[model samples]
Target: MNNIPFYLAAFLVVLGVLIVVHELGHYLAARFCGVKVLRFSVGFGRMLWKKRLGQDRTEWAISIFPLGGYVKMLDEREGKVAEEEVHRAFNRQSVGKRSIIVAAGPLANFALAILIYWGVFMHGSEELLPMLGAPPNGTPAAMAAVGNGELVRSLDGQPVATWDDLRWMILQKAVDHESVVLEVVNERDEISIRRLYLSAAGEQGWEGDALERLGIRFYRPEMPPVIGKVVANGVAERAGLQNGDRVLALAGKEISSWYDLVTIIRDSASRPLRIEFERQGEVLSVDVVPDAVLERGQTVGKIGVAVAPGPKPAREVKAFVRYGIIEAAGRALEETWDKSVFSLVMMGKMLTGEVSWKNLSGPVTIADYAGQSARLGLDYYLKFMALVSISLGVLNLLPIPVLDGGHLLYHMIEVVRRRPLSERAMEIGQQVGMSILFALMAFAFFNDLTRLFNG
Candidate 1:
């Protein structure tokens, strides 16, 4: 869609993979519990491909829509089961076994998240460091005691090691007009502290200003001029710039920091600028002309090169070594639990009017994010997938009638009463669940549509 041909392809691949893994959990759990899974389908509606597998004659198929999938087990509730196979029917299974099968799907999703996150952490993902860049005129940070060449060590006493950390802290804290003490360390080993109070009346307001006052402003970290990305059909790409290239000078002016290069480029829009950079330790010179791009109604020079963090020595990617099987399992469980808790808290905030519902996203938004992550690199993609997996797991566990959590609720009630729910009651619950689920889907779908059309 938005100039990304491979975006849809990647989304489908990831969605398919996650669905297959989730369904496999149900299928395996059913098989182990002495139940027959009649069909294991990835997606819904008409089948695109189908095949029988194992002695169970399980119909493994790919369906038309890639939104979700299911394992249709042989159940007497849905239809009549053969006299011989009635013992293996889903409804006839013990409550514990039924619970296990229902729970397995979400557990599988959680497992996939942990594995993906572990891989990403071990392999290394790109992070933007807070490198000091030029501040806009009249901004809070620029006006209140903060200066150039000063490294931001922390915010509200929390360590600001990366640009992401800085951005999060500032955006979350800026609305409060709170005083922030900046720990600055210079090249001469001199450490100085500066306190800055954000202006509450300014247009650059912080997030949730009414609740708290925590004044902070984000500053670009002062990093060496290293090329991180070269956008396709952009100035840097046309200039033959590649990743890992270090900028030495622009327009014959010595460039020490990323900010210097950015300032020079922005000031030289539509004009030929001479650049000196190093690639593979070999210095080279090139002429680059910046193009103008309109953003927020202002025309700015666009260079199409992403500034990278400091370089690290090349090393082979290695897998994390587990101390023991028990330790690994424990860690996995803890990770999953933490992610689940975080998701629940966030959702609660959203529901309580503390967070905006505008932040809600659907498959289209997720696909866009997935595509962007894929474009970034493998590590980014892995992290994105892990986050998505966690989100999916949390969503499925929500106590809605059509979901695993809903089934668990029914099972719990049955266990307490020593009997299954009535067919009519179950049918009513299903209908209510369908309504709630469809309403949520509609909301998310419209959110996506709004973004697309508005853009």
Candidate 2:
């Protein structure tokens, strides 16, 4: 099935919600500060919908573009205000009040992230075991002699309970250091310390996938070649295969596990293969021609059958993380703070050329991730949203022009000087800020397309 629709919808949902939430913060702050609000706009360009409401008759609007939004308060700087309404102008407010109104938008984004994290922590998530797979030759994990079945115990003396913890620790390390010392426990209950070095190349931590650079992967248990569900009207079903059928052999070769069956099928695309199976304790044989499917750049065969559900691990491969409301709130706060700081540090790295600009992502990548996370479940989707929200908050706080932080910068200058900059100076700053913002957008978009084509 096509995923375009799903991605489009997900992108819209995520962007729309974030923009509205951000603007609402400005709107609320403006109202509380006794400013006259003229318009609240979600998205940009031509108005698709509008309504005037509240005591101020504020015109609420939804517009054509979903890329950005704003809240327009009545300000004397923008235009002349009537005598009676001059007190309600945004420009008439004290510097402190004006700054609060300006800062609220980005702060709202941070608050949203905290709330989402709180909800997710309260609900809990099923976590994977922190087992490490054998690293490829010449990689950091291999260089460290990281063994298979070694459980990641900690990173830099910090206890890491799951892959999430490990990833967070690695990201934080990337911000300020060239390497991290990992502590792992082997199958023999022996603990070892290993150093993992990072590179700006396609080495450790490329494209934000720390595992690939570290040469570590998830370790899963063996899977038997028993069919779970045969796709309706698929090759396997058409060939009379049934659920619970144990695949015995393929093309006269014995099939030991699902891995073996998959390998054979992938290589036998559009070709006839003899499949021997056991159903109801009776042996049967079927001639199946697998459907050819394009994967990556090659054609692969798929029989439309999947392995049966495996048994839950016996206390070694799974973890569930949850907390009571009070505990969850504290954890949520810590989580938000950690992620925010990590984001800021990473941005600093990118600015200083320590990190590649290719790591920057645009709407296309965000949409794709949104769809994938949604498919994973609500918990994953919420996590993705929270992460994005935090990023938005941090990005806006950067002292760049044409952004919230840029406005804050102007206000800060005004504070010390006790007067606003000249209109001409403000205009020049706006032009510079616009240039920087557009350049960043272009880079992000270019990176997005590059990943799409290469991937």
Candidate 3:
């Protein structure tokens, strides 16, 4: 409940940026191709804000719907055109030019992704070292004899500096392939090869906790039970708790680690807790009533206190990934291309029944991802935006009517036959395309609902 406003703000920012850039691509391309744009909208349905701009007097608008936007150009197919403006109509353009205009939107998304990746790479972040915990029993990691204190050196021959790198590699392989060979350095300082077989990975594998699917968990350092920062007006603050207070016990139970304290607090939502702590060598006990808050549809207790800072490692364990300008740009392009190709491949697999349709996601899933990434930090949020942009590019290129790719398909046919499809044929294509799109939307929404309820 406390983070809802932050989450919504993050979600809206990501959606607005992506949607505006996507529509701007079409708008620019249409103008360049000599098509007179009638309206450039940042959303759909009822207009909330509108203005006429440019020599063409294009009706620029911001609408109520935030899901998508469009650049509407003068089209003879859709409506009657003025005698003098008929030449500037979208339908009057050459097949090549029309294709360019239609394809520009997705291309813009890909370009945005490349730029985002480049920026993120330039401003690299500190990442946790790639250390593996013991694999769960009967899981692929366990079957392969993965150890608890081993450090991951690389995955499939690609050097991994951090857990993020290793996680991404594993997910990419799992989506398209069935196995991954890992190179790791054990605590004894011996290097060995371990193969993790993901043959059981299905479409549903992509949703939820991916690391859990692989039977892996991040190793967290144990922290002492001590109060760090207390939120203003929170239960901890109201109870007169101060920073640096060492919590010795909660509800008459000894609390050794921060994790133990968290579990106890969460379970005691809206309940009074008798907390014993050491402050300046003085032991004090206080009865505090935790505030109840809704967390993903369940009530949880929150004292609004953070963990005290821990000592830094003797040797720097955090890894940073950065590159020179030229290298970063090249890597950015490569990453964008790879992400786009992988997205397309996943869609194909899903269609072929090799991947589960349950992997499909709707706005709820996207919103959750946006919120999670934003909470992670700027670099993570940028990466998430880049990944989503690539997906938009790839999905828009699919040969379905009413989409950019569908229009391109029509253009190609027109080039070969030297004539556009009949009006009736186009109408039928639109109907078929609409049906397929609606079905996909329904499936994605259903999966989202299932996730919400199950979670």
Candidate 4:
């Protein structure tokens, strides 16, 4: 709750930047095509700030609504044009020029995404390796006999470099295939193939973690149930627990390992527990109520204790991934293209009922993600922004009325027919487009509220 203000600020920054980039595309393209831009607004509805600038005296404005913005050009269809400035009107431009102006907005968003990805890739960051732990019984991973501490090398012959790569490949494949073959190398250096069934992936409507549904998890090193550190003013500190204390049991059940203690604590949120431990050479007990906190939108118990340091793992669990300037630029282009295609595929699936519409996220969900990514670090925040930029670009390019793509569509038709659509027809198309957009917004908002309450 205390972070609400920070979250709002982050969301605003993301929205403001993307909107400005989008509108700037149209503004620049219009100016290049000799059309006069009357206003360049960062938002809609009642104007809050305005300033006239440039030789044409274009009104630069900010408005109340934050969701979107516009670059209004001087069009005779919209209003009267002076005889001297008639040649500079948007309607006087060629079809090719109009199409370029309409398409530039979405293009700008895509360019921004590519630029962000390029910078992040070049700067680099630590990423998790695609290492698998023991699969739970009866899951697809178990059926494939996936071993603990197995590093994924490839999925269905496609190379897998990091955990992110693995997840993305699996999602792409699972959308169409009932099974995927994974090539993995175990700790013993033995490489093998594992055919994993993914029929459930489709049935689940892609709602939770895909890896969890398949019983695939990251490797966790086993350690003893000893306290390495106790957080100040936390539940452990309040209960008189200290460093170097070996946990003997919790609520009369023997604590065999650190994981066992964690499982108990997580499932016992806000519940009182009797903790028995060994302090020095003597045994003692303490009563504590685990603190309930929201983690990833789920309520979990925490004792504010740190895991004791143990021996290093035999295999690397993380990798620092970076690329050279040229490689990073190439990879950035690929990433942008791949994500844009994936977004379109998901939307198509929704229309076909192959995927759930609940997957659609609203402003609230986006704000939540912005806050979380910002908290993670600059690399993650930039990646999140890049992803949102791609989404914005793809959405605007959709052939729906009132969107950039819709304007391009009109221009395309004009090219074919050698005439523009009637004013009444254009207005009707705008109305229909607005109605569709509104319905989608309503559904997305409902989904957001559902997640908030359910979580």
The per-model lDDT (C-alpha) reads: 0.74, 0.85, 0.85, 0.91
Worst 10 residues of 4 by lDDT: 199-208
Best-fitting candidate, measured by lDDT? 4
Q: Compared to the true structure, candidate 3 yields what TM-score? A: 0.81
lDDT, candidate 4, at 245: 95
lDDT of 2 by residue, 237-328 (tens): 99999999999999999998787799899999899999999999899999999898855334689989988998754338678988899998
lDDT of 4 by residue, 371-413 (tens): 9899999999999999999999999999999998888888888
Please state the error at residue 64 of candidate 1 in Å: 0.8
Off by over 4 Å in 2: 187-190, 199-205, 222-315
Q: On a 0 to 100 scale, what is the lDDT of residue 110 in model 4? A: 98
- Candidate 3 has its poorest 10 consecutive residues by lDDT at 199-208
Candidates ranked by TM-score:
4, 2, 3, 1
Judge candidate 1 against the unseen true structure and give its global Cα lDDT, from 0 to 1.
Answer: 0.74
lDDT of 1 by residue, 274-341 (tens): 88999997999889889975432234687899988664422211223323555545645655676677
Better candidate number, 2 or 4, judged by TM-score:
4
Per the 3 Å backbone cut-off, how many clashing residue pairs does candidate 4 have? Answer: 0
For model 3, state the Cα shift of residue 291 in Å: 9.5
Query: How many steric clashes between backbone atoms does each model show?
Result: 10, 0, 0, 0
Candidate 3, residue 52: Cα displacement in angstroms equals 0.8
Candidate 1 ranges with C-alpha deviation above 4 Å: 130-337
